[model samples]
Target: MAAFLAIIRRDLRLALRQGSDSLMVVMFFVLTVVLFPFGVGPETGVLERIAAGVLWVTALLASMLSLDRLFQADYEDGSLDLITLSPVPLSLLVMGKVAAHWLTTGLPLLLAAPVLAVLLHLNQDGFLILIVAMLLGTPTLSLIGAVGAALVLGARRGGVLLSLLVLPLYIPVLVFGVSAVDAAVMGFEVRAQLLVLSAMLLSALALCPWAAASALRQAVE
Candidate 1:
């Protein structure tokens, strides 16, 4: 327990000290979402119609931008070797790292989503549900991204490879996240979509840490 908290704190401090990684993620998210208005024109109805998909997809991509760095710093500095050999379970450490990643990456995106949604003219009725859905969904994104980050450790063009490995996996989350918001906007029952997102989060929580730990072990060996 102590080691898990320690790993999270260490990563959080490193992320804070560097700062740019998290900043880059938010900047990318804002820039990409902001571009939609220009590309699609200023049709309020059009923006409203596509807003949920645009926000969810842009958030997914923004989250991926920082994933390659999730383990790369530790792996490059040889800290990963010591971490893998620690008395504490590697899976627990991976969870700590994922938690830290979510804090730095996902949390910021969650906070930023509402503002961008307004810019996209997302229906006011869907605003609360958008936040709710992202709350259930973004951590799962971090968890799944960790496995890809771990698997691509020490590889060339790891960023590209990580995206390929994870994007397909991200589809279900994207689909349900957008669906939850859209359902709310259209006066439909959103419980089912939210339930599916919650289930995916639970499933990923159970599996991704162990999978990422195994991949990390393979990378180090």
Candidate 2:
């Protein structure tokens, strides 16, 4: 347990020292969402109609921005080798790093989401679902991204590779996240969409760590 916490702490400390990734991701999400108002005009109705999709897509892209570094820094500095040698289970260690990634990247995006949603004149009816959907979805993004990040550890143009590998996987989350908000906006029940999002999150939680850890082992070998 201590080692698990220690890995999370170590990754968090490193993320803090190298702060640009998180800052950049948040800024990208804000700027991308902000651009929609100008491009589509400031009509509240139009903005509200599109807000769910805009936020979900931008958040998806922004989340991808920092994933390449999740394992790259450790791998480059030989810390990854040390981690693999540790007595702690590699999957647990990978989960710790994934948690740290979500803390630095996904969590910030989740927090900034409501502010951007308001900027788009999002429907008040959807706000709760939007927040709840993102809270459930963003961590799943980090978890799946960890696999992509680990898979491309030594590959050329890894950022691009990571995106290619992961973006397709992200589609379901994007679909249901937007659906939940859109459903709420339309006065429809969002329970079904939220349930699907929860199921995906649970599935990711059960599988992604081990997949990422296996990829890490392959990368180090």
Candidate 3:
């Protein structure tokens, strides 16, 4: 238990010390949201209609911006070797890293969504649903991303590779996440969508850590 807490604390401290890492992800979220108005023109109806999709897409892209470093820095600095040698289970270590990744990347994206909502002139009703969907959904991103991050660890142009490997997997998450908000906006029940979203997230939470750990083991080998 102490080892688990220690790993979480160490990663959180490392993430805090590297402040730009979190800020950059948040900035990307904001920038991508801002571009939507220009790309789709200044029509409120159009913006409102697609705001949920736009916000979710922006968050996905922003999260992708930081995933490579989830393992690369530690691997390059040889800390990964030390971690591999630790008595703690590798999945626990991966979970600790994923937890930090969520804090540094997912939380900021969620925090920025409301502001992004205002930019798109999103309805108040839609705003909370958007935030809710993201809160439940982005953890899945962090975990699924961990797999891609691990798989591409030593590949050439790994950033691009990570996206290619993970983006397809992200589709259902994005679809359901966006659908939840869209359903809310259209005066439909969001429960079914949220249920599916929660199910996918729970499934990913169950599986991604082990898969990522296995991929990392292979990468290190």
List TM-scores for all candidates, in order.
0.99, 0.98, 0.97
Candidate 3 off by > 4 Å: none
lDDT of 2 at 146: 95
In Å, residue 79's CA in model 2 sits off its true spot by: 0.4
> What tens digits encode model 1's per-residue C-alpha lDDT throughout 1-221?
99999999999999999999999999999999999999999999999999999999999999999999999989999999999999999999999999999999999999999999999999999999999999999999999999999999989999999999999999999999999999999999999999999999999999999999999999999
Compared with the true structure, all predictions reach lDDT values of: 0.97, 0.94, 0.89
Global lDDT of model 1: 0.97
lDDT of 3 by residue, 77-180 (tens): 88888888788989888998998899889998998899889888877888778888899999999999999999999888999988999999999989999888
Candidate 2: list runs displaced more than 4 Å: none
Against the true structure, candidate 3 has what lDDT?
Answer: 0.89
**Residue 185 C-alpha lDDT in model 3:** 78
**What's the TM for model 2?**
0.98
Q: Judged by TM-score, which candidate is best? A: 1
Candidate with maximal lDDT: 1
Q: RMSD in angstroms, candidate 3?
A: 1.0
